[model samples]
Target: MDIKEKIRNFIESNLIVFEDEAVFTDDDNIFQMGFVNSLFAMKLLGYIEQEFGITVANEDLDIANFSTLNSIVRLIGKHKQEV
Candidate 1:
């Protein structure tokens, strides 16, 4: 699968509530949907760095960049471009 698909699958698999799997969409706000907590955010960061081989900078830790699958994908793209 492509990066976005990979991310979507990863997020879907790691959702806070298992039954809400199908409820997540690319544009959906994960935090607003109560999908992310502090611990989960760090887990997501680790996943992004490990899966994409790109480190997320401190300044880039803004929740906006991680609020949705689409945003995360865009953030990864931005990081990749910078690399």
Candidate 2:
């Protein structure tokens, strides 16, 4: 699957919302919407690093980087380029 799809699937799997209730676009802030908890951010960080073979540095641990699907994708893209 593509990067967005992979990240989408991972986010969906961890969602606090039911399948029917889980409605979000790539630009939506899942964290602000309460779709996931703060702990999920750590899981997402690990997933992004391992799945994409990119390391997330200490300076890149901003919540804004992981708040939305689009943001997460952008963060991954940035790190992938660094790799």
Candidate 3:
């Protein structure tokens, strides 16, 4: 599957609010959708680390980089390249 599909599946599996039916895109606001909060974002970071096999620096944990599926896909692409 593609990056968006991966992210969407991850969110559906991990986050309670992001069910299988939830709609998302690169421009969708994860914060605004209530899909992610400060607490949940941490969990998301961990999930990303485990699923993508990449390390996320503490300084890189910010909403701007992860506010949408598209942004997250881009970040994951970069991380995968580094790996």
Candidate 4:
């Protein structure tokens, strides 16, 4: 229902590989967890923009912003404030 839970659900649902869902946490490094590939990050970027109505700038695209639920939430908050 919250942002973290929404992100966690989205990532788990979109995962290409079937791994133990229990392995994910709000702060889990999704990339390090092997939950996504590079292109998937782009897909997630689009989802963030559409779902949160925030545009992520080119400079903001990086693992530091997309690698965890909490980080994505932070990125969304940052962009929302810029609106």
Candidate 5:
């Protein structure tokens, strides 16, 4: 699957949404929506690094980069380009 699809799947798999039809857009703020927590961020960081084969710099640990699907994709794209 592509990067966006992979990220979406990973997010969905970890979400504990109460509504069966709950949906999130690429720009949605997952943290604000209560779909995930801070701990999830660490897991996401590890996943992004391992899955994309790029290291997340200490300076790149900003929550804004991982707060949404689109942002996460952009962050990975940035790191991949760096490699």
Candidate 6:
């Protein structure tokens, strides 16, 4: 329904070991969420790029933009506006 829900659903669907009972809030550290490694991060980036139709550059791969769902949504909004 919303961005948070969308992100949660995406993660849940894609991550096989991700349990539904895990605490996933807007402020939760995605890096500390256990299942997120470099490979998973890249996969997530691919998904974001494909889903939102935006190219995420190497410089944009920092945690500032991809830290959480809220941050990622804001980054996507900014990218969409620029596009």
Q: Compare the candidates by TM-score and give the number of the best one.
A: 2
Worst ten in a row by lDDT for model 5:
13-22
Each candidate structure's TM-score, on Cα atoms with residue i matched to residue i, is: 0.89, 0.96, 0.78, 0.87, 0.94, 0.78
Inter-residue clash pairs, candidate 5: none
**Candidate 6 residue runs with Cα over 4 Å from true position:** 16-20
Compose the digit string of candidate 3's lDDT tens values, residues 1-83.
87688878777666656375566676988778876677778777887889889998777777877878888888888889877
Q: Look at candidate 3 and tell me the lDDT of residue 42.
A: 78
Task: Provide the RMSD of all predictions against the true structure, rounded to 1 decimal.
Answer: 1.5, 0.7, 2.3, 1.5, 1.1, 2.1
lDDT of 2 by residue, 1-83 (tens): 89999999999999998888889999999988999999999999999989999999899899999999999999999988887
lDDT of 1 by residue, 43-78 (tens): 889999999999999999998998899999999999
Which of 2 and 4 is the better model by lDDT?
A: 2
Best by lDDT: 2
| Residue 67 C-alpha lDDT in model 5 | 95
Local distance difference test, per candidate? 0.86, 0.93, 0.77, 0.84, 0.92, 0.72
Cα lDDT of candidate 5 equals 0.92
- Candidate 4 structure quality by residue, lDDT tens digits, 1-83: 97777778888888977766547777888888777888889889889989988888989987789998889989988888899
Compared with the true structure, model 1 gives a TM-score of 0.89
Off by over 4 Å in 2: none
Superposed by TM-score, candidate 3 places the C-alpha of residue 7 at a distance from the truth, in angstroms, of 0.8
Q: List the residue pairs that clash in candidate 1.
A: none
Point out the higher-scoring one by lDDT: 3 or 6.
Answer: 3
lDDT of 6 by residue, 1-83 (tens): 87557776776665545476556777666766764656767787787889888888777888767767788887777777878
